[model samples]
Target chain A: MMPAALSEATPLLSVRDLTVRFRSGRETVTAIDRVSFDVPRGRVLGLVGESGSGKSVTALALMRLLSPDMAEIAGEVRFDGRDLVALPEGEMRRVRGRHLSMIFQEPMTSLNPIASIGNQICEPLRLHLGLGRKAARDRAAELLAMVAIPEPRRRLDQYPHELSGGMRQRVVIAMAIACEPRLIIADEPTTALDVTTQAQILDLLRDLQSRLGMAIVMITHDLGVVAEFADHVQVMYAGRGVERAAVRDVFGHPRHPYTGGLLRCIPDFDGDQDRLVGIDGTVPSLTNLPPGCAYAPRCERAQDDCRIVVPDLEAVAPAHRAACFHPLEFAREVSP
Target chain B: MLNYIARRLIYIPLSLLLVLCAAFVVLRATGNPIDIFLDPNHTPEQADVLTARLHLDQPILVQFVIYLRDVLRGDFGDSLQFGGPAMPAVLDRLGATLELLAAALGVALVLGIFGGIACAVWRDRTPDFLISTIAIAAQSMPSFWLGILLIQIFAVDLRWLPTSGRGDGWHLILPAATLAAFVLPNFVLITRTSMLEVMGEPFVVTGKAKGLSAAKLLFTHVFPNALNPILSFLGIQVGRLVAGSIVTETIFSWPGIGRLLIGSIFQRDVPIVLAGVVVVSLFIILANLIVDLLLSINDPRIRLG
Candidate 1:
């Protein structure tokens, strides 16, 4: 594997020891527990996690979208030489659309329904880039064309309801890329779309990333998507990342039992198994997390001590790390 | 869209016919109009002549047909007290009612919508709580009582405004305020509720993520998106306000159609009362029709024929 070290310039986005907690009533619930990762310039980082695993929360935290009064955030989110966690809202506003952007999960609802598609696309450009009305409008049409939306000019005047699901997702992508932000965070961008549409959107994202040379934080539970697009993969469990590695290393040598369990759940094309494998237990609740490793209760290779002691994310290989008391052996690996 | 509008339009005449028929039957059931005007000196022959002259001696069905035909011909008969065409009398008083409606609606909309927006933006905060409480209290308060309360405070006690009657803008204050109080709560509640719901929508999140200021996000994305439902709601409320002006006008002695209608009822002036009812009904229906058209115009998704 390549060294994958930080080059001379700063990483596009670097998050370290990010913790998020909510004070509801008298209890303090941890939403994101010491989560950390980095996205190098122009590379894709796939954050793989199931529901309640802090994937979306992390994205919201990065964008400072969560209410500060409600959610207590403690972390260092350094991007382009500034600590986003410490930035004031006014300065944060400038960084948001101009330097960073996000695409949401549901295309059906992720647009202002009454707003014309063209106007919505032109909004960020006008606000961030200071483009004139005619110029922004023209640029919006170009973006639509870039996303392969047919009759881009006409589609601009149409409302979101007039467009198909795939078309709406494309429009969402067009909005995210409007300002040419250095980084884009897309959370489950294709979960609401059909399989065919999902593939098209993923392809569009890949094409845009290469052409624009922008980093992407692709958050999804679908490993297949990560394998196809991401350079690095981070597997999160119970509000914290349990594994971090290059996409190939994580897939080829899944050292953590939870990561191995996730990989085993994926159906193989040539395997003779009639039923697919699934992990035994559900993700732990935020307010009632176990004292030990969050995935220990569900780990097949769990030891007695694993139930009492939390595991640190220690290095298992070059550019590969996993949090597990007893790491998985390589003999059970399924080649990607 | 055209088909939808045409279909809605076709229901109007049918509804008017029903209302006309109902009003005719109900008015006759109330007893003889001539008996109320008779003095002890009047002989039975005089009563008969009066009854025949007014076509009251005819069969009920015949009278109804004549009434319908006359109404179609723009004749609403003569007023018993005023002794002129009842239609013209009612039409003359309509201006006062319209003025009250305009002022009331203007206050209700401005206060209600802005207050609702404030509540939604600061939901669960102190301002939200205060505004919501006021809205609830206003909604529950009857217009008659509210009018008296306004008169008691501003007219009787403070002497800052007139107790009753409409001449200048100052005289309109109490009545319009009472009516506006009745309407304001609904606007506040609906706007707050709808805006809160829309604020939770994914697009709102997208707007925030796009670095839009709170004000821009609200007016541009949240408020506009939340407006269609409120517009349709406002249409219904406006139509209701026109009809509801009866009580407000009577309490304030504002010389509107409502006050005139009540006086005609006490006088057993059937033609005048019926004319007033029909005119007011027509106004309400027309207002609602305009509202429907406006709703369609505001929302492109709502196509009109």
Candidate 2:
């Protein structure tokens, strides 16, 4: 509808102040507190966070998948020039699977056990694309082949339990990409898989992203995955975004102490170390988070100001941002 | 699939043999049928003649062996009360019982499944509260009391249906409704619970994310997975319903196996009672087997196993 130049300049997904609060009895706990980011067209944005850091909640909110009875979401999620936050449910559903899709963590439980893989893959094609039964089946077979599943035709009639874990995940990916969505939200897609399978899946996702030019929001707790796959990185702590920058900048010039702690937690295979370094404390409970920065309690750099007031996510470098008053000044090189 | 069915079919006769042995021992332990069957003024010589003729005078083990041989030959001996073969009499009443059972099952499944799905879909809302309250109340009410109440309302005052005695479809209304009322609650509760659980499964979320309509998600995904537990429960309910029909049959005066079994027990008609036990037990066993088969077909995991 608009001029082509402005549309080309705009990111594929632009999220601003996305907040999610879950209600239990009388108390309300904010799971995602005013987090924001942008994913440029065809780029991969890594959302790194520990458990309870609101990564999954943010993903579900973006998709409008969270149950309204349990969660209250407020924010702007502008995707492809449409206001997704304010879209009606019926309209949102149309956006889902057709233009925006999601790949879940546990492929074991993601697919319907009773349904054939073919039918599962065919569902979205038939739903959004309006493909007939025979057409859907043919498209489904092509999709299975695209995901690198062996014997795609025979595998179509196979149930979930008949397939191995890796194959099932491939089938799930096949389903996710069936309609050739413009964006895919992969929430820890490889966490449940073995190391070899994880690499294969990442490779497949990377290959698919470039070939299809679909923006990807890769949500995970693994920094290694970010280093390997993401072009940009956003680090979250206690339901808030603490750092946002390009993958190379965030890794080389680690700004937030929490982000540094995460990078250090990964075992150094070349170095002489007896044990792996872990962040000292657990993520604070959402209902009882500190008034100041939620990570201040666990941060070694905490000061009087850090305990008294929260710091806003401000630019540290040209594009790098971190929400910390005492961010590291010097850049430390870390090769991917 | 055929191999699985064959394996199950092979168990039927072995299970029936075990039932027959238990029945023979328990029936003999109830005391000789001669004492209850013979007239009080009958001569001692006449009683002795009857006992020997019926094989009651022989050792229990010898009588059991003779009984097994006769049963293997499809001869259940004569019903002392009916003065006919007990098997035929029991079989004759089976059709009526099966008819009542089918009607009652139809009523229960239709109302119960729909009610359960409603309760689940509208869970924690006014409709769920209302349906759950009604289901609990219905479950608690005895079948006989319900039958009597239905008779009072529909037959006595309203004059819409016959009060008792099985005849045409009109006579079936009250008894079948009563029997169904007792079981319908179980179906509602089970289906609701199963549906709730299945609706929470990850595949359901996947279905939702696929932008499938709510009804499509429910019918194609949730209901199918939920069906396994409901089917298993249905198998168990069939056994209970067959036994439960005794009270309903007696109240409604429906000439079913339950009524026949009740009359035989009261009159100490050993042959008829034994025949009824074997037939009912066999029916329950077969119903359970069919349910297991259905479950295997419905779930691939179970099928492959």
Model 2: how far residue A291 lies from native, Å: 1.1
- For candidate 2, write residues A41-132 as lDDT tens digits: 89999999999899999999999999999999898999989989899999999988999999999999999999899999999999999999
Q: Highest DockQ among the candidates is held by which one? A: 2
Instruction: Give each prediction's DockQ, rounded to 2 decimals.
Output: 0.70, 0.77
True-structure RMSD for candidate 2: 1.8
Encode model 1's per-residue lDDT on B154-204: one tens digit a residue: 999999999999888899989999999988999999999999999989888
lDDT of 2 by residue, B157-179 (tens): 99999989989999999999999
Superposition TM-score, candidate 1 onto the true structure: 0.95
Residue A142, candidate 1: Cα error in Å is 0.7
Q: What is the C-alpha RMSD of each candidate to the true structure, in Å?
A: 3.0, 1.8
Where's the lowest-lDDT run of ten residues in candidate 1 chain A? Answer: A1-10
Best by TM-score: 2
Clash pairs, candidate 1, are B1-B304, B1-B305, B2-B304, B2-B305
